[model samples]
Target chain A: MVTKFRTTIAALAASTILATSAFAGELVINTDTSDPAPKAAFEQLIADFEAANPDITVKWNLFDHEGYKTSIRNFLTADAPDLANWYAGNRMLPYVNAGLFEDVSDVWEENGLNESLASAAGSMTIDGKKWGVPYTYYQWGVYYRKDIFEANGIEVPTNWDEFKAAGATLTEAGVTPITIGTKYLWTAGGVFDYLNLRTNGYDFHMALTKGEVEWTDPRVVDTMNNWKELIDAGFFLENHSSYSWQEALAPMVADDAAMYIMGNFAVAPLREAGLTDDQLGFFQFPVINPDVPLAEEAPTDTLHIPANASNKEDARKFLAFLATADVQTKINETLGQLPIHKDATVGDDKFLQAGYAMLSSTDGGIAQFFDRDAPAEMAKVGMEGFQEFMVKPDRLDAILARLEKTRQRVYK
Target chain B: MSASRASRFNQRSLAPVLFLAPAVLFFLFYVIFPIFQSIQISLYDWDGLGPKTYVGVDNYVELMDDEAFYTSLKNNVIWLVLYMLAIPAGLFIALFLNQTVFGMRLYKSLFFFPFVISQVVVGLVFTWFYDPSYGLLNVILGWFGMGPIAILGDETWVTYGIIFAGLWPQTAYCMILYITGLNAVDPEQIEAGRLDNAKGWKMLWYIILPQLKPATFIALVVTVIGALRSFDLVSIMTAGGPWGSSRVLAYYMYEKAFSEYGFRMGYGAAIAVVLFLIMMIYITFFLVKMYRDEKGL
Candidate 1:
């Protein structure tokens, strides 16, 4: 069945490419990154794709992160890209629900993508349909300065208490302990996710965001309480309200702050700041209470085709190409992210290697980041609630109550 | 003779209507049409795409119980009321600069500078100025033996801080308008009032005050609109943050329709309708006054 599906997708894309080329048609692709590696990767892909199948020129409308969101939405509702890179979780659900995205389930089955795909990526499916394809994903956790840990004679922590002690060790060294940028709000969400996942486990996080569980549940309260304890211990940087994540990265790299709980993308910036692989290391968020079921760090970021696409066959071809082991390995090596391809080879970046090991060996996947998992409206409200809790722990009940009200209005 | 007179009256009436056609068309298409569409959209449950469900008054009903919406609405009211202080403050400065002094023209131009720059840039500049550790305001405060305060981070003070930033330019705008009005301030009356011993505050109150009414009205109109339309500053400075304490209706509407969360366009339009209704109160009053004055009543 999978073989037949793959063959059908290949045939379909080939025909579309052939027909489109005969007419001098152009393809537009919208992407979120202009990073050197991805820019080069995309250009190479376009060059190769065009070389193999002449007559279809590709136009790249690349934007930075924030601009990409706005531009993509504007373009989709007006004139959309033939292929676009987007988040795969509930972030893409609205488009799917609106029938704005085309189902590429045939392409997924044909490419054998559904066979080994983890449920994390599989969660992108809505109403038993696939809207987009997985490109590259990375695990988010604490990227600690290994040298600092070594210099202070503190071992990397594997559990919650030891993590707190490690934080104390860094603090006693006059380090800010954990560097974050709450100004963007999502950084706070990253911390909150790590804490919540560690405390309440993956299923409950899903339950809470899906409105199946109350945000004021004892487990949820415990998550906030856990975060407050960290804050009370002076684990986070002071003046977090004023700094951005990139700006906060400076202190961490400077050894003034010992760790940053960030995603795999942060690896490149850390390297750019002159930190060597041997100098940095990763640890899964320490288990909270040790009684909670262990959940891996979040794996997210996907590439999908727009449903209103003009050349969906070519789009499917591209998704299959992206899923191939060879391309995945090459992209992974350059981008320093985890390849969704089961047999893809990883490169020598210690941080990437560590993240690869952690995510590959995890017991279960934590679908998407908090913001991506929840409905957009609910996530925004909930994230603000998280920030408010961080700002004033005493307001936890009020914040949860407010978010509960939003969930009722939104989900209903 | 009666037929010729009737033709003459028709031409007189038609000429003014022909002249007003373009402006009326523009206003209807751009202003009147969109407002009605927004109101209609607000009556539905839509996410900017797919099917729009007819939710009737459900959206408004939901909004009434929404603490976030109420918080935003209340904040907007506070902004509107506090933002009006700019008019009188600007008038005082204009009166200061209305005299002959050394390089008064240069001083006046410099004072008017903030009003000319874009609001986005103004928001950024003020954000830096209000930064707790490194901001200029705090640096000066530190020298005076005061400690740093997180103006944007503290929920209690953030709205007031943004309003202060907004006032800087608003006051300048009002000053320029007042200066224009003061230029035509009937100088002979000032001398007559002086002769009558109506000096200082009394002279200004009884004589000069009435003449500045036109400028005051315009300033009030602009100030009120500016306050209600204050999304750029809040978006830039705090993004309705430090616990969602700084949100006003405009920013709240934007957050609902766009941004990271789902695009709840119908709900967004509903919030926008509420904001519009509140602004309409002031807008109607201004229009009525303008209409009366137009008729020389």
Candidate 2:
């Protein structure tokens, strides 16, 4: 009895010491994972993290998707949470430059994330230092209707000419070749990104978005001319600007439209709208110029610790925990996206598998979408110009001039 | 005793100022102070995260060259002019529904229903109604062998389309005002005009209109303010889209400051200052007219 009591007491004392050694503080996290899948992913992630570290208590604040964009600016400068969610690439440049976010290169070095998250490392780096850890990303490509393609006798286009021919064939069949809603403007940006990436190569496209190349550069005009051909052929849905990205899905679902250049998230809604796997397929955005190497767009979502955070130690611990291959696998499973960790296994969902395969083979480069690659002001102006160009192809010169003027002002 | 009585008299004189101080201070703090604050902010360059840098009228200069600003300004003017139609339309509807009949209350409520609905709901309803593929508007047009006009999509018609949606609720609000005015209207004068052989249009023009002056005044003021501050509908329906053909000054300010890509607080403040200056002109005109009319009475 005496020996058993002594052993129990010793075990209790060791546990107490372990608990005390663990940073027992409230770690506040703010995130815009308000979408059902992402919300569930975060809920599970937080619960598991808490279970792993018994002494640490987490306080999570879920923010509205749209409102959080502006609210992050407010909270980061004052009354900041220990960690927050943000996007990768130039989108986080403003915060990084302002010193609102904590530099977390140490986390990357210690966790061997330099090798594990290598594909996204370039995007996370600014000034030769990693700013945040990208957790999940989804590929953007041409999501088309297999039934419509079959009906028109069109195969998946591998090059620019074939893509145009497919659109022409679909158009002849009285189906809108490409369905897009430029109402919110980012849909047009996606189309522009793919075209520019394919036409000018990823490096030139990056230079253009970074404001190093002038907007009126001949290469940009080449891209615009290519886009104009598609527009002139009436390849897009009529009155597309009147609808949102979701609303445009109606025509595609009803077989009035054939294809949409969109991200993998569209797969969910398309599935929900009753499109079977046999009816739907995704193809990489086709090559525009044979000279340019193929690149892909996969906008990444990332997490960061604020510079003003009180509990840096716990935040770093949580960052390491969140960056684990197992955690990433679980996250991407729920998020319907690709995981950043190299060893993270993706779900058997056909679209997820396809995205994983496509991204894996991409040797040229990966872009973080147009709006994310460019600064915010430039993105807004550039997308507006793209929408206008898509509608009135004749306005290309004027739009390019306006964009050039804006680039001068914005970059300055 | 004499000195004490003098002090009491002074206290009586000062009591009204003391009583008025709280409200005056609130007005200064909430309304007047913000106007100056916006003007001050307009002269600086601020992204809300970093320190503000004063650029001294540069934002205003930039606005001069901004085509989008011109577009918003032109749209605002269109809204102001087109919005005035609500008042006359409301008066006519009030005249039609003013008659005593069975179930008139139900009809009146039905007419007032649009105003009772929130602006967000109204925006959504109209957005669906104007939808190119399946909207009721297109359905009606089909029966007439007309076009499936994409009003919201066309840059030419986008502003007008948003104005039409805004007019629905404004018309209903004006109708309620006219209804209440018609209730308070002098039946004796209407009878006098009738006895003078003044028939429908003449009676409404001479007799009924004079009494509705107050209602017209209130309606005009509210409509103008509503037209100027049309941020909610623009935000909800199209988000000033179809390439920003429908943006107003208020919506432009929000886009500059609070939009996902926008945190240029100084530019937003400049826009707010411009909008406030425009509103002040009308408000001053209203105050002067009201004062003159009161003095005349």
lDDT of each: 0.81, 0.91
lDDT of 1 by residue, B57-87 (tens): 9889988888889889889989989999999
CA lDDT, candidate 1, residue A374: 84
Segments in model 1 whose C-alpha atoms lie over 4 Å from true places: A1-25, A35-37, A116-121, A253-255, A274-279, B1-15, B294-297
DockQ of each: 0.37, 0.42
Location of the lowest summed lDDT over 10 successive residues in candidate 2 chain A: A15-24
Docking category for candidate 1?
Answer: acceptable
The TM-score obtained for chain B of candidate 1 when compared with the true chain B: 0.92
User: For each of the candidates, what fraction of the native contacts does it recover?
Assistant: 0.48, 0.80
lDDT of 2 by residue, A65-180 (tens): 98788767666754578899999999999999999999999999999999999999999999999998889999999999999899778999999999999998988889999999
Task: Report the C-alpha lDDT of model 1 over A1-412, residue by residue, as the tens digit.
Answer: 2243235544654453222231226777778878887777777767767776676667776778776775565556555678888886778877777677788889888877886454444676888877777767888888888898999999889888898898898888898889887877888888888888888788887888788987767888888889999988989877777667887887888788888989988888888999987898888778876767667655566777776677777767777777777777877777777777787887777777887788777774555787888887788888888777776778888998888777887787
TM-score of chain B of 2: 0.95
RMSD of each: 6.1, 8.3
Model 1's A-chain: what TM-score?
0.90
For model 1 the local lDDT of residue B254 reads 92
Give chain B TM-scores in order: 0.92, 0.95
